[model samples]
Each structure stands twice: as structure tokens, then as C-alpha cells.
Target chain A: MSNQMFHTSKSFDQDLTETTDLFLEMGALAGQQVAQAMHALIEGDMHLAHQVVEQDSAVNQLEVLIDERILLLVAKRQPAARDLRYVMAVSKGVVDIERIGDEAAKIAHMAQQVAADNSGTYSYHEVQHLSNQVRLMLHSALAAFEHLQVERAFDVMRSDGNVDFEYQSAMRALMTYVMEDPRQVSHVINLMWILRALERIGDHARNIAELVIYISSGTDVRHSDFETVQQAIDASKIG
Target chain B: MSNQMFHTSKSFDQDLTETTDLFLEMGALAGQQVAQAMHALIEGDMHLAHQVVEQDSAVNQLEVLIDERILLLVAKRQPAARDLRYVMAVSKGVVDIERIGDEAAKIAHMAQQVAADNSGTYSYHEVQHLSNQVRLMLHSALAAFEHLQVERAFDVMRSDGNVDFEYQSAMRALMTYVMEDPRQVSHVINLMWILRALERIGDHARNIAELVIYISSGTDVRHSDFETVQQAIDASKIG
Candidate 1:
């Protein structure tokens, strides 16, 4: 009877490992969708924009699937301690990813609007730069999650401040341009909305990085000072 | 031996009940603080705004306390099925409440700015009305949570649209006021930000209500059609 119980427990642990692997797969797909959306925006590819919108539904579906699976695992297995936190983190991480998908969809929608306007007056270079920065941050954040790299996750968090700073500058620049040339206000406003959406994407990526840190370190570093979070991570590694 | 086992299980259940009750108490306090912050904004009471800001730390403390307690329970009890759902919901609920507190602090900060200017140029009546609506919605949402009243929660979700509409109108009115007299633009802009913050409060309240429904019905109602959510709630109640 003891031998049978051990075998069953081992299988259950294997099942959980598989589930975690699936979650990582879903995360990678969601990240790809976000990056593609950014590319569509920068390249002015309406087809790609539409594709991103369509792909968002799949991301949303995956969020629901992952949530249900986590719920079932918690219900059936009664996960304790670290395993409990891992499941909970997966649930919240999926939410962050879904929101990222929504932000990507918003970007795609804005891209469509910009395409329709046929203004050709506003330069896309600044917007492209901001998009690339956010995409890199998101990519790094997801990679950090897969590898359980606390330092990489912290890097993602610090990168968020740069995204916000750039977004603020873009806002000011766009506002000044609109103030000077009222005719271009509509186009500039559309671009501003896109920039805001990208900045929100960065925020969600930061949230995912924080969740990664929490799951790996078993500490709630949310709203903590940056240096404090770094110290907590280091302590967790040592302990 | 069976009697001793029964006693142990009963004590464990009682502890969980007590912990859940504590979470509910904390949630209630957070909701009240949110309402008071809105009141401060409408009344232009800098003192009350300061009080709200100070009280926010207490809310943050409660969030941490609740989180730690929940983690301890999961580690100790190995609760299953519905019990797991309840604990997970409480954890998520506390986070939402903390965010609600943050939004209240935001509104209070904006109120301080408005009070400092001492400009009677812009009346707070419209924002006051919107704040009242959102406050009531938040109160009802929390009450629905306490009672698990799916119908009332759905009502809260429906009211979100009204709050959004009011906020948009408020924004247009503020923009028109600023356009008419550029001198009061700064004050009006501050008020606009306050209104946006309140609208976000409403959004978060709706999110909490949706979460409550999810916990009670085991259904993911997010992104579902309004009629579908209502139908699901009705089904849950009937069954």
C-alpha cells in the first residue's frame, strides 16, 4: 500500500510539472502576440493588425483555460506552501498576460485608426522607438519568468520607469505639436492613445516580473523599494 | 479517536471562519475609506483628504496581514475544493481592496490640489454627483460580496456603464470650461483628473463584483455579454 501511494504521489507531481510547462508555453505565445502587434503598428500593416486582434481571442481563451486548470489543481490536490503559491502565481500571471493581450489589441485598433486617417503628416519614428523598448522589456520579463531569473525580472521592473519617462515626454511633445498645429490634433491624439496603450503594456509586463519574483522568492515585494526587493531576492537565494 | 478527530477538524474550520471574517472587516473599512475620500473631494475638505491619505497605510497593513494569514491557512490546513476557492477569492479580494484604497488616495491628493488653488471658478457639483453614484455602487458591491448576492452584484456591474457615461460627460464639460476660459484650465484639468480617478474607482468596484460572482458561481463572467452574465447568475440562484 505504501508503494502504491508513493507511485500515485509521483504521478501527481509529474502532472503539476506538466501544467507548469503548459503555462510557460501559453506565456510565450502571448508575448509573441504582443510583439507582433507592435510590429504591425510600426510597419503600418493592417493585415497584421487584424491578425493580432484575432489572436487576442485565443489568448483570452487560454487565460480561462489556465485559470480553470489551476482552480481544479488547488481543489483536488490541496496544494500547500510553495506549491500553493506557485498555483496562485500562475493564476495571476495569466491575468497579467491577458491584460497584455488587451493592450496589444488596443494598439492594433489604434493602428487601424491611424491607417484610416491617411494623414501621412505625423512621423512614426518616436512611436516606433517606444514600441521597441516596451517589446524588449516584455520579452525579457517573460524570459526571466521561464528561467526564474530574479535579477532579470528586477531589470524588467526598472525598465518600466524608462518607458513611463519616454511616454511622458511623448505626451508633452504631442501636446505641443497639437497646440501649435490644431489641424494635426486628431492624428496626434490617436498616436498618443497608442503610446499610452504601449506604456500600459509595459506596466503589465512589470507586474508579471513582480509575480515572477514573488513566486521564486516567496516574498511580497510589491510596492517595496527597488533596493529592498533586490535584497529580499538575494536573501531568498541564500536561505 | 473519532471524536478527537472531529474536535480537531471543527477547530480548524472555526479558525478559517474567523480569518475570513477578519478579511471581510478589512474590506469594509477599505470601502468606507474610499467613500470618505470621495466625500472629501466634493466637500473640498483638505483635512479630510489628509486623513484619508494617512489611513491608507492602515489599509496596506491589512492587506499584508490578510495575505500572510491566508498563506498560513493554506500551509496548515490543506483545504480543498470550495474551501480553496474561498481562500483564493479572499486573497484576490484583498488586493482589489488595496487598489481601491490607492484610488481613494489619488482622489484625495487631487482634492488637495484643488483646495490649494482655492479657485471657486469650477464648481465640484458634477464630480460630486458622479462620486456619489460610484460610492453607492462600491458600497452595494461590497454588500453583495458579504451576502453573496449575485443579483446585486450584477446590478453593480450594470451601474458601471452609467458611471462611465457620467465621467465622459464630465470630461467634455471640463474641456469646454477650459476652452472657454484658459485661465481656469489648470484647475479644470485637475478636476478632470479627479473625475478620471473616481471613474477608475467605479471600474475597480465592478471588477470586485465580477470576482465575487466568479467565486460564487465558479463561472468566468469577465468579457461575457451582460445578458449572459445575468443569465448565469440567475441560473446559479435557481439551481
Candidate 2:
């Protein structure tokens, strides 16, 4: 945000800083959960998966807190355009982070489901590959958000297509696996659910990236075409 | 909202009403799109399916409008507790409705894919059943949200379990069909995607129902046990 956009109220500035800190902390926690949830699944550690599930409540609480703070801040300060955009992006970004937490819990739940019965173990190389890609995407996206870097957000957005491609390929390969061996249907289905959750996390990261770009450039890059976003990225002013 | 909650300015009430009116219209339009998307798939009418995808932008625009009005109202009037909760619920409610529209578009996109290669005609009875169930859920959920009917929202929540059961059954059946004839893998996959989309729509409707209860009771019923929600529904102040 620009210096001119900052209000004179000391409390307002402090509250904004506190909220941004909370949001970043929440995002980092959620990213850790995503990684740990995948680890629990790959290791077949039900205890760790349950821990991930239990930790989701904390993420939920943070979302509620962040949203309440945002509404309060907007009502009290009535900041200028840049600050308003920042507030809006953070408010919207919290939801995606919360959703990512939910997705992590979903991955954990799927892990528990697969372990419920002594069934065949589904392969995880592709899932791990996709998870790593999204985890990195999320990490970079969060950094971009922190620094208000629109170009970094564009890079995150570009990486998402590869995640999509990986997801579809994994889904098709899983479908083929089940078709080849009828008995593997249940096992493969559980794995597919995990893949779907990971794919959704990637989408949420992309959403946060778009919001980051919006806050930085005052542009709605969400539903715009690739060429439009690319041109905006090319012509963007700040780092 | 209570009389005390209303601002002295007449435009406050007018803007609130306008926002609510826009939300209800968007919900109704999305419900219609979901119905039409299912119809397109069952009848192999790619035209209607494509129409659903193309028309999603309008629903999206309504969300943007509702959100903007909400922020403006909060910044201008700073509504009291009761009105604040109502505004927050409505703001969050629009996200679920917009997501429902995206799911409808997803169903339409899947329909277009299945139609691209007419290898087989997927069964429609279960698909229609789940589609009808979720459409009704969205309809009733939206009504409950409009009227703040906690009991009706509870009823909507109860129906979602049946949708989940049916989705699982349909997935199992689809898997068996693909196993029986590998040539039908692509066709079965498309049907599975449609089922998944419908299932997700049901989930979104359930989320909206929970929000309705929250707005009415000022209680966070989300993620609460069904028994707890049921008790709250029984003891709720309003219908």
C-alpha cells in the first residue's frame, strides 16, 4: 500500500499490521498441514492424519477472527483505494487459506479411509509430485501476497496449469487402473479423492495469486484471459 | 432485522433490500442453470449445456455487485449486531451460490465432453435423481436463507446425507460398468464427473443452510454434530 493511503490513526495502522501478520501466520500453518497430511497418507500414519484433522479447528478460528477484524477495520477507518484493495484481498485470501486447510484435512480423511480396510495400497508418486508442486505454488503465492508482488503472482498462476495437467493425467491413469483390475476400484477411488483435494488446493492458491495481483495492480485478473493477465503482468509497475 | 438495527437513513434499508433482491435472483438463476445443465446432459443437447457455461458470468457479476453493496453499507452505516450478522451471512451466502453456479457450469462442460465423442449413452435415472434432489435442496436452502427459517434449513441438511449415499452408489455402479467394458471408460468418467459436480452442489447447499441457521440464531452451527444442530433447530426462536 502507498504511504498516502495510510491513515493517521495509529490504532488503524496497528490493527492492519496485526491482521496481516495473522493472515500470513495462518497461511503458513495451512501450508504445513497440507504437507504433513500428505506425509501421513504416504506413511499410512493414522495418528498424524488425525492430528491434521484436529488442527483444522484452529484454522477455522483464524478465518473467523480475520474476517471479523476486516469488517471492523473497514467500518472504522474507511481507508483509501490502495488500503481498501489490500483489505479486500486479505478478506478474500483468508477464505482460500481456510479452504486449503479443509483440503488438507480432506487428504487426511482419505488417508484414514484407505487405511480402514486392509486393501491394496495405491501408488503415491504422482500424488506426491502434484502435492509438491501445489505446496511450492502456495508458498510462492503467499510470499507474493506478503510483498505485494504481482509478477510473482503471475508466475504462480502459470504454474497452476501444470498442476491441472498432472491432476487430469493422474485421474485418467487411476481410472485405467481400476478398469484393468476391477477389485482395485475402492482403493483407487480413495487415492483419486486425495488427488482431487490436492487439485482444489492448487486452485485456491491460484485464487490467492489472483487476489495478490489485484491488490498490487488494482486490476481484476481473476476471470480475465491469459493474454490479458500476461499483458497486465508485462506492464505492471511495482515489484 | 430489528427496527433498532435499521439506520436513520432510508437508503440504508433500500440498499439492504436491493442486495437481498439481487442475491435471491442469482440463486434462482443458478438453480435454473443446474436444472438446465442436467437436462442438456440427459437429452444430449449441447446447445443448452453451452448456454449454461456462457451464462455463468452474469451470476458472477451479481456476486460482485452484492459484495460491493455490502462493503458500502458497512462503511456508510455500520449496522448494529443483528444487522451485522445478517450482512455477514448474506455476504458469505453469495460465495456458496456463486460456487453452485460454477458447479453447474462444470456439469455443462462435462456434458459437452461426453457429447463430443458419442461412444455410449450414459444412464440417466440415477443422475436425474441426484440432480433433482440437489436442485430441490438448493431451492429450499435459498428459501430458508431468505426467510431465516432454521427448521427448513435443518431439513435441507438432513436431505444431504441421502445425496451423499446416492452419489456413492452411483460411483460404485459406474466403476463396475467401466470394469465390465473397458471401452466405456471415457463415457463412465464423464458421468462420474457429473455426479461429483452434483454432489458438490449439495454440499454447497448444505453450507448455505448452516449459514441460515447461524444468521437466525447467532450461533455457529457449522461443523457441529447433526444432533446438536437438530437440538438448536428445535429450540430456535424463529421458524
Candidate 3:
């Protein structure tokens, strides 16, 4: 290859790295927000909850900036094949990260409501456990993306069933509370929304994991069962 | 332009048109699924609900096909400026349409559950009205995308406020039912999930409308207030 071609390719690689770095930065911030929001909710820290809400703008800004970089990279580099798929996955992954931030903010809002409405100590242990599980999933998914490790992505996918199960268990427990004291219905509903937000965050993490698989395997694993996705990943590895 | 350049440009335009048409087709199917699911729920037609559940795969297939076309279009044509934005919007819009199908399928599942548990008329009039409003919003959002009309997009944005209002009202009314008869708690919760799905469907439609605005004005109106988005649309028109 010519020197000039080599130089162009190196610069393109640098651009891709920089773009991925920005995406990881966004993911880290989103993960932090979810953690902080859950901490605030569990501890009834209104100030921390407000902070999470305010910090969401940073996540949104990162998303917009990352999207701009992606558009420029595509328009200039016009990356082909694997490079193209990688860029597309990065673009979609940024979206899911942004949504995670949104869900965190939503959780923060509900936390504030729960704090305001309930004077007594809120004793929803399941929400805390579920939030922890979801945060782990989010962290692992981001780690998978940063390292391009399909194993970590698969780990995240496998954990989602546990999150769903915990969510159902939490819902059932909350229902009993609501049924026992209808007056606590509003407060319980707020907790339910918090649980729902956490579950959705888990889903966004799964989506990121799927994107990781897509980038590595050139497979659209969306709407596919776990077995199918696993087979696709294994085949890609062997090939 | 030279003849060869003109020929290439014309073919690119045809590709863009075909991609957009496929996207619109998916959007229409999603809209129908939502409507049919609602109809099945209110009328308690298990067969129709199952049909909606089954048809969702078609929407997923369209989404995958559209994504393939978009990646090819971007890699081959290297669309820049307005054309690039249009393609990006179409890509994201297809994801939202597919999600709309998912939400509709979720509602169908809940409807089936509700049918199994209760023989009495499921008097969720608020859900019916909310479904109608959301269907209109979805239809208008698709129309806006097809025609590239910011005004229609704005209309969908404004209607979202109404959908939210209706959703809260539905929730409050359902709460009263649960409070009055704790035996109906399970049924009410199912209805609440249905309401939640419809509200989310409205949100996805709003996201599509935002994409429409983004395509037309090159402004990322996401996470912006109505007044701010309106100003951006107005400025784009003036510019």
C-alpha cells in the first residue's frame, strides 16, 4: 500500500477510536446516573435525586455530540463492511445509552414523589436489589462494548431473566401492600414505576449487548431467542 | 451535471424512495396492530388479539429489511447533507415503528389475560379513548414523515399532552376501582399495563415526529420543550 493510503487509514482508525471513547463516556455517565438515582431512592435523598435529574442533560449532550461525530465519520470515511457495521452499532448503542439516562431520570422523579408522599420509611427491599442487578447489567454491557467482548455481552443477556424474575416478585410483593392498605396505593404505585424503570434500564442494557453481538458477528440478533443469538455468535467465531 | 452523474443521482433517489416506502409500510402495519389490539381488548375478541400478536413478526421483518437497505445506501451512495439526514431518520424511524409493534403485542397479551380472568365487560372506556388518540397520533406522525411536513409533526407533539392527561385520568379511575373492590386488583393491574403500553406507543410516535423535524430542519428536537422545538421549526422554515 502507498504511504498516503496508510496515513489515511491510520487517521480513520483514530477517528473511530475517538468516537468509541465518546460513546463509552456517555455510557459511563448513564450508568452513574442510574446508580445515583437508585441510591437516592433507597436512602430518600432528595438532593441526590435532583442531582441525577440535572445531570441527565449532560448525557443528552453527549448523545447529540456522539451522533454528530458518527455522521461526520460516515460521510467522510464511508467505511465499508465491518467498519460500517461497527459504526452503525455504535450509533444505535449511543441511543440506548441515552435512553438509559432517561430512565434513570424517570426513576429519580418517581423517587422524589415517593419521598414527598411517604413520611414513613419506605421498606421496598426488592426495588433496591433489582436496581443493583440492573446496574450490574448496564456496567457489564458497557464493558462489553468498550472491550468488544461478546462473552461479557452474553453475560448481560443471561442476567436479564433474573432481573425480570425479580421484577415480577417485587410487583407481587407491592401488590400485597396495596391490597392490604388501599391508602398506600399511590405510594406503592410510585415504587412500582421505579421498578418498571429499572426493568426498562435492564432492557436498554440488553439492547446494547445485542449491538455488541451485531458488531462482532454481523448478525441482527434483535427479536431473536437466546439460543439463536448464541448459535450465531458461535458460528461467527468458528468462521 | 453529466449524463453518468445524473444517472447515478437518479438511482440513488430511487433507492431512498424505496427505503422510505418500506418504512411507511412498516409504520402502517404497526398502527393497524395497535388498533386491532385495542379493538380486541375492548370487544374481547381473543382471535383478533392473537392475530395482532402473530402479525408483529412482519413488522420486525420490515425493520430488519429496512436496516439492511439503509446500511447499503449509506455505504454505497455515501449520502451527505439533507439526504444523509433523511436516511438516518428513516433508519431510526423504523426502529420506533417496530417498537410500536412490540408495544401492541404486549397490549394484546394483556388483553388475552384480561379475557381469561374476567367474564364481565372490561369497562375501560378511558383506555379506548386513549387508544384512539394514540392511533391518530401514530397516523399523523407517519403522514408527517411521508410528506415531510413539520406542521403535522407539531400536531402530534401537541396531542401527546392529551394522551398523558388521559393516561393519568385512567390510572386514577382504575385506582378507585381497586380501592373499592380489592378483588379486582389483578384485573385493574392488567388494565393499567395496557394503559401504560398505549402511553408508550404515543411516546414512540412522538419520537418519530421528532425525527421528522430533525430531517426537515436539521435540528435535534429531542429532550426539548414544545416551545423550543416550535421555535427551531419556525427558524428552519424562515431559513
Give lDDT tens digits, candidate 1, residues B1-239.
11111225876777666676776777777777877887787787889999999999888888777788887887788776556666777777776788778878888888888888777488888988988888888888877777777888899999999999999898778766765665564476568667877887887788778877886777878778898897788777776
Candidate 2 has an interface RMSD (Å) of 3.5
DockQ winner between 2 and 3, please give it.
Answer: 3
What is candidate 3's TM-score against the reference?
0.93
Model 1 lDDT per residue over A1-239, tens place = 11111224775676566666676777777778877877787788999999999989888888778877877787677777667777777777877788788878888887887888777487877787888888888888877877678899999999999999999898778766765665564577678768877887888789788877887788877677898898889987897
> What are the runs in model 2 whose C-alpha is more than 4 Å off?
A1-5, A75-80, A115-122, A176-183, A230-239, B1-6, B116-122, B173-184, B226-239
User: What tens-digit string does per-residue lDDT give for candidate 3 at B1-239?
Assistant: 11111235778978888898898899999999999999888888999999999999999999989999999999898898778888888877887898899999999998899999884344878888999999999999998888888989988988999999999999989888876777677788888889999999999999999998988788888878989899889988898
lDDT of 2 at A119: 81
User: Could you tell which candidate, 1 or 3, scores higher by DockQ?
Assistant: 3
Model 1 steric clash total: 0
* Model 2 agreement with the true structure over A87-125: per-residue lDDT tens digits: 877877887899999999999998898888558655788
Could you tell me which residue pairs clash in candidate 3?
Answer: none
Which CAPRI level is candidate 3?
A: medium
Error of 3 at B237 (Å): 3.1
Among all candidates shown, the one with the greatest TM-score: 3
For each candidate, the DockQ is 0.32, 0.31, 0.53
